[model samples]
Target: MAGVYDFTAQSLAGEDVPLTRFEGQVLLIVNTASACGFTPQYKGLEQLHRDFAARGFAVLGFPCNQFGGQEPGDARQIAEFCETKYDVTFPMFAKVDVNGSQMHPLFNYLKNEKSGLLGSSIKWNFTKFLVDRSGRVVGRYAPTATPDGMRKDIEALL
Candidate 1:
């Protein structure tokens, strides 16, 4: 019965953030990278946050360098890049492995609760996991899926 609420992750600022703080809110959790082809999706994610934040919706970004070393930067650098490049206002977490033995606990739960196209391991960066207000993992979106394309599901959860 463990859920997203049962996990905690370090923020881009290096502060510990308990996922329960976001309980009762629809969450779009994404693994991001600064130098990937999908890096531009940050703008769309920020837009989603702006459009639905007041309605109990949040977009949580976790920087991951496991893919092509696209996000190889310290927490400060990652935070700066997100703000300066995308004007991202949503929360961003410290870089973590998304697929492997060292994967973050939150991501392990996400993949177990909602596997993607072929399996539990995330295929690449930008993979998204949507959690309902109840802290249940509700959907898994591929890296190619755009943030804008998830509005309908987000609206339903909200």
Candidate 2:
């Protein structure tokens, strides 16, 4: 019965963020990368955040470099790239490994809650997990899924 609120992650600023703080809000959790082809998606995600934020919705980005080392940057570098390039304003966490033995606990819980086409392991960067207002995993989206396309799903949950 464990939900996403049971986990905590370090923010890009190095502060501990308990997922519980976001309870009762529909969440779009994504693993992001700065140097990947999908890096541009950050703009769309930020747009989603701004559009639905007043309605209890947020996009949480977790930087991951496990795929082709696409996010090979320190916390500061990643933060700068997101802000300068895509103008990302959503809450972003520190770099993490999303598909390995040392994967962060939040991701471990997420992949288990909603496995992808292949399996529980994350296939690539930009993989997204949708959590409902009750803090339960509701849907999983592949790395290729775009933020704009998920508005309906998010609206339904809200």
Candidate 2 Cα misplacement greater than 4 A, ranges: none
| lDDT tens per residue, model 2, 1-158 | 77899999999999999999898999999999999998888988999999999999999999999999898899999999988998888999999888778999999999999999998999888999999998999999998999899989998999
Worst 10 residues of 1 by lDDT: 115-124
Per-model TM values vs. the true structure: 0.98, 0.98
Per-residue C-alpha lDDT of model 1 across residues 37-148, encoded as one tens digit per residue:
9999999999999999999999999999999999988998998899999999999998999888899999998999998789899988899999999998899999999999
Clashing pairs in 1: none
Q: By summed lDDT, which 10 consecutive residues of candidate 2 come out lowest?
A: 94-103
Clashes in predicted model 2: 0
Native-vs-model 1 lDDT? 0.93
Q: Predicted candidate 1: what Cα RMSD to the true structure?
A: 0.6
Off by over 4 Å in 1: none
